[model samples]
Target: MNLPDTFHLIGGDALKTGTGGSLEHVNPATGESSTLELAGADEVDAAVAAAREAFGVWSGLAPMARRYLLQQLARRINESAADLSALSTYESGMPVVYAAQMAAVGPAEWFDYYAGWADKLNGEVIGAWDFNYTVPEPYGVVAAIVPFNGPVWEIGMKAAPALAAGNTVVIKPPELAPYSSILFGRLCLEAGIPPGVVNVVLSGPDGTGALVSHPDVDKISFTGSAGTARKILAAAAANLTPVVLELGGKSGVLICDDADVDSAVGAVAQFAIAQNAGQICTSPNRVLAQLGVYDEVVEKLAAVAGGFVVGDPLSESTQVGPVISVASADRIVGMVGEGVSAGTARVVTGGSRLDGPGAFVAPTVLADVATDSRLAGEEIFGPVATVSRVADDDEAVAVANGVDAGLAAYVFSRDISRCHTLAKRLRSGSVSINGLGNHMIYSPFGGKGASGYGREGGRAGIEEFLSVKSVSAQL
Candidate 1:
């Protein structure tokens, strides 16, 4: 796939030059250079200005018109799924089939889901006054800083709700993998979305800083590490702009003695450490199993890890692909080594990196993980799962909630009542019972504690781009 010589989009036009220095785009599957472009401060300013101008027209449009345009955008995205998925695989190192399902089709579905809400946003009448009502109004211009792991999906995840709420957006795609985002900008134009309504700026930290700090930017929505969220919060504070963050997670899964051990193991293998090469924020990094079934669970998890095919992401049969870069693989391996050296955990299988051209790390499983250790508390965004044994349900819950990051938690129990009880006790933004799914288009998704604040997805997701105002008049 050949990308345009320039990738930055401003006012619906791809800019051929940027003030910021150029960034080299690497194809992780083959460890080869793909494309290069400069995304800098000047481009960010132009995009933000265009979004501010377009906000007046977009927000003034009839809600039905907005809905129709969004539906069309979804259709265009669906039609482009194959090309987008292939480009995403090349840029982000995700398996082609998974990319098509999650990065392309999943995002298209979200646009359709949010499109249904465009005309449904309503105000509430209050009884205190002759004519009083509370209205939900768009924040005008929104800035979305998306992560590299799932660039295409994150773009739709942020832009769909913002647009549905009548807000225009300026997006800063991650520098590492930005082709799909730039392509999406063109697709928006083709779908009849007005210029500036959906602008894409492909810059690194400098451009991101400019967007967040721009006075005209009414709101900010960011998805990535907690440390970066802190920086964005600080920048947004200058203008007192409202911000929503979806940050890191050391998400855990609790397996009770009476749980479906086989299903739980399969979930850990498939969702926790294998999907997207474990680059997901809500991947199950920690596993707390009841002692009665701990050994069996560990063995099964090890077998599944050993079976993963680490190869080219473009291959249909490959299950696990390379991490985004070699540096990322090294970081993951370093963490595993730290766990082993501290005697907090022992490698069950696949502790080392695979011998290949791409940045591949073996799907690793660590047993006897200490509940208080770094492996248990830290977010290891890699294909590794650490298992810790617990004595009972109470201890399992305690161990699961021990970490500071509380984005998601999973529980596996045969008894429905037991699962519900455990789910309530877990202090997380999302808790899954008997499975390992993160977000749905109709449900709110976010994190608590150090995992960061605010919610995304569903009605709550669109509401993030809106501000409430109550008006009253004397009878």
Candidate 2:
């Protein structure tokens, strides 16, 4: 992958320097290192000022005219899919093919998906005696804080809808893997986006805090860990600026007593890791297998864990790759060790770090993990599986809904009625009856409690960047 001359794009220019010191990354596979300057308060102020200036011109354009520009961006993204996918793999150590599907193809699709909505934003008319209708208008400057795990897709997820709703954006990308998102900002310019209409800043916490707290930024959309979300929320509260957050989850994969053992095992095995080495926010971290099949489920899961091909992410044949950084890998392993030492979990298969050059952890399965234990309850963003037994359907439902998060859940059962009943009881935003890790872009995706509030994807995503005004004129 060819590195761009610089990583930050502000007001239609690629900047080579920033206020803070440089941020560096060593290639997970090769240990080769690279650095990009970390944008700071001054940079944040400039990006916000740029977006604030561009808002009037951008929002004033005819909806269809805005659509035309966005369509051009989508086309360009599709043409450069190969380069984008390669860049993601180089930065995040994700499987190249997975990167192509999840990150590369996603931005183009999101742009096209929302482009149609540009002209279709409708407001309802209500009247009994006099004429009255609602108008949905852009929220001015929108600050989008994107996570490192799925940097490319998260940009499209937050920026496309915000742009389609007539709002200008200042994207704050994490320093870990900001390359693709920075490129995205350049793509906007290449596709005819006016200067100051869209900006990207490669920054760490200090800059991010500034962006979220800036009074000129009317709205903020964030996708990241729950811990980070809290910090952003605290800053936004000062201005009372509304925010939309999509955070991590310890999602449950519940296998009913009637479920086909093989199929249930397959869903847990694949979705638990999802080929991104389980770094996904909605990856099923805990498995609630019915007691009738718990033993068999654990046995098969262990076998599947051992079968994963852990190697270089750039290779097409590699099924599992390194986690993003050495620190992340160490945290994951330390969590597992803590669980074992507490006597709440036992490793049934692979557990230790692999003898390799990159930050690789062995794909692991911990059988009979206590349902109430930290190992089963917390979000473990690694290539590890925690399996526990559920006495019956009631217990499974209770355990599934027990966590503070409710982003997603997966259930497998031969009985159709059981699937329907459990779907209603499950607190998750999206529940798969007999599937795993399947997300529909057109559906409303979000959570109820600790998973954070507000929604993204489909028309719901577009609305997050808008505010409604009720206009009533005497007829």
Candidate 3:
């Protein structure tokens, strides 16, 4: 597959110079690599400047006009869905079908959803001494730093809402998988989005720092690990710039004794790891099973994991693909080793890395995991699941909430009332009952603790890029 070698900047320009350095873009599926230019501080400055320049014009446009442009951009994205999916698969090793459906179509749908909210961004008319009203105004230029996993979707999550709220954006796509983001930028221009309204800068942490610290950048939206969020928070603090962060998660799935063991195995446990090779931040890293059905759940989970089709991401039949990089793979393996050494967990099905060229690991299931073990507490961004037995519902909830990150959680139970009660008690940003889906384009998704703050979808998402102002007049 042919790919652009230069960084995508404002006005649809792809420039190789003015970048700090270059890095090889490695295909995790094949271990093949290609050199790609990395945007430097200068390019970041240029992108931020361009966004700042465009904010006045873009934000000044009528809400309906902005809505129309966003709809047009969504149409362009849908038109190029197939290409975007293939590019995502090539860069991130995501299964082709999943990439097409999730990354491509998902983002397109988000743009369309956010478009509908453009002209509907209303404030409030308060009762005061005079005619008092409020207005939600855009925060000028927004800097969006997206993670490697689900790059296109994250871009749309940040950009769609920002644009709908009448803000221009400078996006910093992750270095690991940036091809699709650049293509999206090109599509923006094709859809008649004004030059400098949407800029894509391909860079690593250095460029990200520069972009966040730039004076022109008014708001920062980021999705990545909590460690990175700390640094970004520090940098944004310098300018007192408002930030919205969606960080890492070690989410848990609680399997009740009365739950359907088969559904819990297939949907809750298996899908968590097999999907995106468990790179998802909200993947069910820990499973708390009631003691009454703990053995059955573990057996079924292990069997389902062992049955996953681990192979080429491009293959139609493949269910699981390689991790993003060798370093990530090694980290996953080390985590597993630590669990085994602690004697708190035992590998049930698959554990070691596959003997091949790609950075692949077998869909592994660890049973009898101690709640305090590293494997149970840490976010393992690989196809690995740890099952821990709990005595009762109280213990289940306790184990599920006993973590630094509380982004998403899952509960499997046949009783609706019980599910609702548990869902209310779970200390997670999102709680799914009898399922695995966490995020939707129209739902307000975010976390409470180390998982970070601020919602990223629906009306709440668009408001994140907006600032509230009150207007009063004498009647």
* Deviation from native of the Cα of residue 3 in model 3, angstroms: 0.8
lDDT (0-100) at residue 117 of candidate 1?
96
**Candidate 1 vs. true structure, TM-score:** 0.98
Instruction: State the TM-score for model 3.
Output: 0.98
lDDT of 3 by residue, 13-112 (tens): 7676556688788999899998888888988988888888888899999999999999999999999988898899999999985888767788998899
* lDDT of predicted model 2: 0.86
Report the lDDT of model 1 for residue 244: 90
In model 2, which residue pairs have backbone atoms overlapping below 3 Å?
A: none
> Cα deviation of 210 in candidate 1 (Å)?
0.8
Ranking by lDDT: 3, 1, 2
Candidate 1 lDDT over 256-314, as tens digits, reads: 99999999999999987789988988897689999889999999999988998888888
User: What CA root-mean-square deviation does each model show from the true structure?
Assistant: 1.1, 1.2, 1.1
Query: Which residue pairs clash in candidate 3?
Result: none
* Estimated TM-score for each candidate: 0.98, 0.98, 0.98
Across residues 81-153, which tens digit of lDDT does each residue of candidate 2 receive?
A: 8878887888888888688876668888888898989999989899657889999999999999888788878
